[model samples]
Target: MSELERRYHRLLRAYPAEYRRARGAEIVGTYLDLAGPERRWPSPADAADLLRGGLRQRLRAAGAADLIPGVRLAAVLAFFTATALAAVWSVLELHPPRAEWGVPNAGPFVSLGIGVWAAWLLAAVAHAVAPGRWTRRAVALALLSTVAVVPVAALAGLPRPPLFVLLPQVGLGLVALGLPDRLPASVRAAPLIAIAATGLASVNVLPRNDLFLSYYSWTASQILPGAAVVLLLVVLLLGAGLALRADHRGGWALLVLLTPVGLLFLRPLGGAVDGNMRGAPNPGWPVLAATAVVVCLAGPALLPLTIALRKRRRGPGPVASGDRCPTCGRTAERAP
Candidate 1:
């Protein structure tokens, strides 16, 4: 085989082995013919198209044809939620109360998290207006910055949020990485709108004393932190509802996306209830963590059963004995 044919075959590896065995040569031939003489290396467009087709075929074989659309919806929602939450948290961190405690001013430029969130925001904007390649590059940069900030912040002795809190940002970013190359204008604009609205709310709510010390305190008394939790829950639920209206695939994606959010809050909720953040070791942490794990998994686990039940209901229900069709009020025809 020539070098061009070899490369084409390699790209075909994206498909399942069985599919490759059945159709790989045909696909490679089509591309090879298109390449003509003196052509080496698949064009970017062809590579991307092949990869996408392979992924769809794989999903279809897995009986998950809806997964692509579901994942795309989840990615958009997760990205918006992550960026907005980051903005609120960043602003909340900047509230004046931290200054009295010698916490460094965490402006957009000075703080690791601020920088990370800024990268995410830029990526969101790029997803909205930039080409697919540029959007992907921007998203990759944002994810890298998010992951890198943890070690850097720790090394620098910067005050960081709890591990659970930090994890959702990373989780959401990973989900967001699957966002479709194209999106509706409203979908593209959502993150910016969420950031603007949440940022302003966080700024206005102003953290009460001791708010930062226990960020998950949901008491309306705590204002900023409380609003943050409420805002996150609302966004998550609304997005889940919208996605679920479409299909079970969205339900699965929502479950996947909610796992990190559960982790983000459960530790703090445990601590707040047990007064652990006041310095005592909370014995309830393990129990709370386990419960959270169960809760997160339960939704996804039940989804298949629910889908099965719906299918059963739709199958061959008893028809009225009026000898008429249910639709168009037409008389039913009897088979000989």
Candidate 2:
């Protein structure tokens, strides 16, 4: 199969397990059958058809609701678009001294703008393309990898590369290689560790003031602490989730408590350079305010990283129902 055709088939695994189980091989075979020869590349039309099929698989995996398959997707896309627009508008309009037209400081707005869009776009593509365990883990790695690259790029004045080009290539490669081991475990393992590494590395390399650059700007000291808090919260939450499934009320309750502190401390450092629009109306306020406003918004986004991690760790008891143990037709379970 051609590269596009191969990716198209991989995305099929993102649909619901039953759906994939029923149609996966058929989907792969269909691609192979249509391609004329396994070694031959797909025609442009064949490639387009498979691309649409891949998107359908991704959409199916996101949720089973039928109200409008595209609605949630539209909403998700609109959200990021609004985020990007708000950031850019704030910077350009409030370029400098207005400080009143909603621009606080172009710096915070800009950084937030970049962070929101980067997170949103990669996330959307991940959702669009991911059809199963391996792809998702690989996508999680890609995001962490992006976080890793940001600092390296910033500190080294590294060349900027197009993410659209990079994500699929890298994500596929990771899945092709490490995924054999990465998929069966939790989703967060790679991501949490990777984020932690990114955050930790920033301590020595990232500018202290950049922490204050308005994704809740903090000092470098605050960065590591905050990053640790994030790591802590994730572990607790995952452990709690598993614990809850195992009927460990105490563990769940304790884990719930960690959230406030983490929320109070955690920050999302996008590519912007300023803290807040202290002097301008940047998207800094909205993104940071949003992060602070709703505890749930980041839940799903973070969950991917969490699941990646959880997949690595032990699961909840038979109560962790979705993941049925193949051995006994029982769900993956953990000790309380």
Candidate 3:
């Protein structure tokens, strides 16, 4: 190594000693390639900045970059903020969220805020406990869902969360259950399947005609639609919990797909009343309708965005390094 190379190696001492021991050559080699052969000695400040950037990148992967906590907090805030804001309208109008008006369901929306955040809480817990493919995907999905829910829910309210929430989870479950032996440690939560099953089973179990007639006014039962939504919420939590414990890949994936799909037919409007219907109860706000449209149409596309970001952060490893055999000591071992 020349004098410039020597100084660069010395500067690398600022990095973690063990990390330097393992990856020091590769990292320094990259910097050397960037700086080129005619390099001058790096100033103390330059050395410090390189070390800082490296450390920051590492921390972003391992530590504070866990966006779940922040997302959950935001969900919580959305819960209260939306509820409080809508409450003012309720007071002024002298009525709660009305199905006839086409507004979002206040109680369910607030309740769903809790449910959505709870699912995210489960995801964070899942990531903290396990860091495998399923757990990471679950965490990523929770974060993605959080980003999606904010504006969508702001418009849709709690009347019906989109069906996309837990639909993907069912696919995850099939995969998880298929390979019991190879299942990751985190996807072991036992209750997640039960929660999903309960959700799927309860879709139309609630006495629709009687209940719709009963609490259709004050309680807003008819507008609430199927129990699958609430069940999907539970599945989201339980699925995250399971993802943290056992392997249920296919099941979980399906569960994710189901969460949003369960609410497709559910419409808050009672009947037709567009521009000028004097008898029509102020046909709610279009936020609810617009939200439904967005969640249904936009949710699948949004999923890839989160997954892609994570993949970008975790770029492919060195060509040879990732191919090492776990069972054999031979670096050049053949695939099974």
On lDDT, the leading prediction is: 1
Task: Give the alpha carbon lDDT tens digit for every residue of 1-336 in model 1.
Answer: 999889888989888777888889999999988885988899998899889878765544544445566566667667777777777666755543345566453442335566776787788788778736687688789888878878988798764454455556766677778777776788778777888897887766755534452333442223323433754565567656755544345554555555555544555555565564355445265656664566457635664564455546545333223322211123345554
| Residue pairs of candidate 1 with colliding backbone atoms | none
Better of 2 and 3 by TM-score: 3
Q: After aligning candidate 1 to the native by TM-score, how far in Å is the CA of 261 from where it should be?
A: 3.1
2 or 3, greater by lDDT: 3
TM-scores, each model vs. reference: 0.66, 0.25, 0.26
CA RMSD of each candidate after superposition:
8.8, 16.7, 17.7
Model 1 earns a TM-score of 0.66
| lDDT of candidate 2 over 88-157, digit per residue (tens) | 2222222232335453443433332243234433443443345345444534654465446556656655
Each model's lDDT:
0.63, 0.38, 0.40
Give per-candidate clash totals.
Answer: 0, 40, 65
Best by TM-score: 1
lDDT of 2 at 196: 42
* Model 3 agreement with the true structure over 78-120: per-residue lDDT tens digits: 2222222222212222223445655544443322434444544
